[model samples]
Target: MTETTRTEASKLMTEVEGISGAVLPEPAPAEAVTPLEQASPQEAEGIRQRMAELDMTDTTSIVQFGARAQSDLQSISQEMLSGVKNKDVGPAGDSLRQIVTTIRGFSVSELDVRRNRSWWEKLLGRAAPFANFVARFEEVQGQIDKVTDTLLSHEHKLLKDIKSLDLLYDKTLNFYNELGLYIAAGEEKLREIDATQIPAMEQAVADAPEADKVLHAQALRDLRAARDDLERRVHDLKLTRQVTMQSLPSIRLVQENDKSLVTKINSTLVNTVPLWETQLAQAVTIQRSREAAGAVREANDLTNELLKANAKNLREANAEIRTEMERGVFDIEAVKSANADLIATIEDSLRIADEGKRKRADAEKDLVELEGKLRHTLAAANSSKQAGGAV
Candidate 1:
């Protein structure tokens, strides 16, 4: 890790320790004394032999392990970042909006009975608004069902994301634990080089002759380089561990958001939908009752109108019958009018008979005159014919 990262990690660790009320052991000093100082001659000689046997190759496995751990940590970090980025609640918000719109679309006014319609319109069922109301209700219910399905799907996705986050959290913790072990191992190896191996190599270089000093010094340089490499590896592991630590909370935060969305979806399904449906059903019932009452009122009004008209017609007819019953069998005025009509008919018949007789007499006289004229015309024709013959 860089110096700044190290400093930050240390501060974070200190804060954690303070909150937990647990004091961590202090790190070993750079110049701490080694066991070699207290050892006997044989032990010291054995340690010197072991230090001489140590080569740069001994750290190869540790370096490879660190590299592998770093790669794994990188992969874990990337997976976590990608998961967090890809998770979204926009679909849930859309479902909520759909729900609100569906709820707002409900209007009881649509169910109101049309009172101004004519009797024929009611008889034909045109004035019955319940059919349209029921259709609208069904349509709104279908919309609600669609919203519910969408919410449920979104909730399932959130649940799946939360499960993935749990797995990611576990992986991060594992990486953190692994990094702790790697850092501990690297620190121990570094302390060994600082306290024992390098010191032994330095002593050997000081005691050797000039020609051999160069070889011992080169070995010392190699040991120091290995120590530096181990330190760098430890720092790299610490940085990776810090990344895992940060990832822990990030995964949890994303999971929390998913959980919150799931809770809201559950509330919408379990509470809001049921309550709305119940209220809608009640409204429909009330509207039906109102329509029934209106029908009854219209029937009563029509009955009253028919009764009043019948009563008025009956009164007029009864009055006319009472007047006819009160009068004589033959009314004087009716008899007088009938007698006058009979007399006028007789006079018209007599006048018509006299006129026909006179016309017939005149016709007879005209016939006699016509016959004389025909005879005279016949004689004239005969004389003219005879004269022509004699000539």
Candidate 2:
């Protein structure tokens, strides 16, 4: 017999109970005994509760999510002007001269990753970046934990990942709840820099020094490239958030459906098992437990109706997401033009570096040959003078 079964009988009803008024122990609290009673229920309820808590399964979206961003549009000299004023402009005209020359000598390049964002995504991200931000942070933390464990010998990747998510989630929530308005206000300032400040500054870079222009140009190109990468990543993230969010209810439906299905199965098994067990033990049998019989009958009808109605809706949502994924498109021309001037300045510098190495090698070889010729000429001249003196 099970430990539970052994403890459950009426203690065999002591003999001479009429003379000695048989004593019985107090019953355990209902809450305390409840789990014990449910233990024979096959643990299906526990699994069902846990299944409800997960949010990842019902997802069918691939929409990006994160902060709204504009791709790069400012050049090197313009970048400096954006950050500085007249005194800083001291003799920049000379820098522009050399920068132009440097560009002529080197193979300049502007690099930007292709990226795109639709109005719908921009709207969503601006409306709710936190959802995507949290996911991004979690993903980053997972990568960190994986790398750190390999490099630092830490074994608790899951613990580390969860810890990072907890901290990031708390920090981000506080920022949005307390400081989001301030961040929203800062958006106007960024917009102004883009629409007014940067353009005017670029036009005024007319007299920058050649060397400064070269360095500034390269810096600007690098900066633009970095921004391009960020915008692409954010766009990708925003799309993810959108698709996942959309798929949530359907996924939850599926999860609830799954639990109902399992509960029915387990309840059916337990009901049948007990029907036989009870018959063997006490020669008593009930055709069905109330819950098992009801669940079996109701769940089949309920789930069948759900599949008939909601299955088509899930299929329609899938089509919408698939259309978006297939039509991946973005315009990066503006970004390239903005970084173009600075990139032009690097071409000359790169070429000069390569040519300088070649020139130095040739000069060394020439010097070696000249030294050998000089030694031979000196010996012949000395020998001619010695022969004339001997004669």
Candidate 3:
């Protein structure tokens, strides 16, 4: 039978048991059981050929491998279940591996399918419950494998994110710190202008010869406007600080979470999975007697329960990763966009202030020319008045 067919049959058997409240049939005879012997040369060669045909990187290979194992088991099960009711032990024994000496003493009649259960057999029960646990645990194990592979695939990218974000935050933080110093220095300059320069200019406007009053007033206006532009730049710097403060926390939070996740993954790989493997070894130990089988079943059941509980950590880790990814904390575009806008505004403000200074210089030159022309006209008028008086 195919692996899929076997799996379906297993499920159907379970459903039947549920309806009829009848226990599953006894496990196939030792001859029917496929022991964990080293693969024969032919079987190993076949496995190698099949694996060589597959892409190792493709996750579907995992399923294919499980199916291959199941198919082998199904073939063995068919051989044991076929015509066993009427056949003698001799024929059945002939079909088994040479290691069939273990049960050679038992007669065909003694090995009947409907034999009465011994006291120990009744007490130990079958391995169905343990099998169920193993089946469910296998599913969980597959999930962990996929999750671990995914986490590893993105490991480098996540590290890159942490580095980029850290560098960006540090650079911006330094800039803001320097800006704080600049704002302080600018405030001091403004205070000096208020204390000394502005008052002196105001007095100059007040005490200026009447002809120069308009020129003095214009100079003072230009100085005050330049100071106001400095204040505006300081205000914009404060806003930039606010933006950096607000955005930085989220980036830091992501970085911390990522670090924590790395630690958890390492722990799971180094400690958790290895421990599970050790427990699995104990659970799958080969045994023949009813008591030994019972012990193995209990061990497998406990291991499965422990694994089911531990699987939650993997689920939680994946969920946390998705949350941070959805938040886009590692994406620098938004932060870069905001910084670019602020830089452009600062550049524009500086440009406008420079234009204002050029206008002020031109106004000063025009005032100087007007004053020279006024002096020349007054000299010419005074000479005309003296000449007229002499006449």
Please report the candidate that would top lDDT against the real structure.
1
Could you arrange the candidates by lDDT from highest to lowest? 1, 3, 2
Which segments of candidate 1 are over 4 A away from where they belong?
1-87, 115-128, 143-146, 170-250, 326-331, 341-391
lDDT of 1 by residue, 1-391 (tens): 1234334334433333332343222222212223454555764554454344334557765466455445665686687567556546887888888878877876656566663556776688773567777888888877877677666667656766766766666666666655555565566567777999889999999999999999999999978888887778678767767766776777777666676667677666666777888888897788889878988999999999999999999999999999999999899999999999999999999999999999999999999999999999999999999999999
- How high is the lDDT of residue 39 in model 2? 36
How do the residues 69-186 of candidate 3 rate in per-residue lDDT, one tens digit apiece?
A: 2344345335434623342323322322221231232243332333465777668884443454455446545554544444333333344444554555555444444444444444
Clashes of 3: 0
Comparing 1 and 3 on lDDT, the stronger one: 1
What is the TM-score of each predicted model, taking all chains together? 0.48, 0.24, 0.33
Candidate 2 local lDDT, 131-167, one digit each (tens)? 3433433454344333322321111122233233333
List per-prediction Cα lDDT, in the order shown.
0.69, 0.38, 0.52
Q: Model 3: residues >4 Å from true position, as ranges?
A: 1-135, 154-158, 161-166, 207-219, 235-258, 277-391
Ranking by TM-score: 1, 3, 2
Error of 1 at 210 (Å): 26
